[model samples]
Target: MKAAEIRSKTVDQLNDDLASLKKEQFNLRFQKATGQLEKTARVKQVRKDIARIKTIAAEKSAGKKA
Candidate 1:
């Protein structure tokens, strides 16, 4: 998801999204370890996406506080 899209979500939604992504990341790691993952690069992409979502969520919260 884009930062703009992420920023548009409510804090609660962002938290939910973050939780889901983290779970997916964990599953991906397990897949990688078991040699079941076909696309290893997806792990990196998911990590970056998770970071982006978190950064945007933080920025939105900070903006609201100011």
Candidate 2:
């Protein structure tokens, strides 16, 4: 997902996306461990997406506080 797309989401939406991404990350790790992972690159992509969501969420929270 693009940063601009992520930034457009509300905090609640971001949290939901974060949760699903984390779940996918876990499943990807499991697949890797079982030697069944087809797209190893997806793990990296999910990780980056998670980070992006987190950064955006933090910025939103900080903005609210300020």
Candidate 3:
């Protein structure tokens, strides 16, 4: 998801997305451990997405405090 889209979401939604992404990241790690992952690059992409979502959430929270 794009930063703009993430920014539009409520905090609850972002938390949900973050949870789902973390679960996916865990599964990807397991797949990698078993040597079953098709594309290793997907792990990196998912990590970046998680970071982006967190960054947007933090920005929104900080804006609210100002």
Candidate 4:
């Protein structure tokens, strides 16, 4: 997902998205370990998306605090 798209989501939604991404990341790791991961690039993509959500979430929270 794009940063702009992530930024549009509310904090609660972002949290939910982050949780789901983490679950998917876990599953992907299992797949990789078993040598069944066809789309290995997805693991990297999900990791980046998780980071994007987290960064935007932090920015939003900091904005609120300020």
| Backbone clash numbers for all candidates listed | 0, 0, 0, 0
- Rank ordering of all candidates by lDDT, starting from the highest: 2, 4, 3, 1
* Stretches > 4 Å off in candidate 3: none
Residue lDDT tens for model 1, 2-26: 7788878898999999999999999
Using all chains and alpha carbons, the TM-scores for the candidates as numbered come to 0.90, 0.99, 0.93, 0.98
Where is the poorest 10-residue window by lDDT in model 3?
A: 1-10
Worst 10 residues of 2 by lDDT: 2-11
What is the alpha-carbon lDDT of model 1 when measured against the actual structure?
0.90
lDDT of 4: 0.97
- Where does candidate 4 stray beyond 4 Å? none
Model 2 agreement with the true structure over 3-66: per-residue lDDT tens digits: 9999999999999999999999999999999999999999999999999999999999999999
Write down the worst ten-residue block by lDDT for model 4. 3-12
- Cα distance off (Å), candidate 3, residue 7: 1.2
Which candidate number would show the highest lDDT if scored against the true structure?
Answer: 2
**Residue ranges of candidate 2 with Cα displaced over 4 Å:** none
- Candidate that beats the other on lDDT, 1 or 4, i.e. the better one: 4
Better of 1 and 3 by TM-score: 3
lDDT of 3 by residue, 8-47 (tens): 8999999999999999999999999999999999999999
Candidate number with greatest TM-score = 2
The local distance difference test score of model 3 is 0.94
Per-model C-alpha lDDT, please? Answer: 0.90, 0.98, 0.94, 0.97
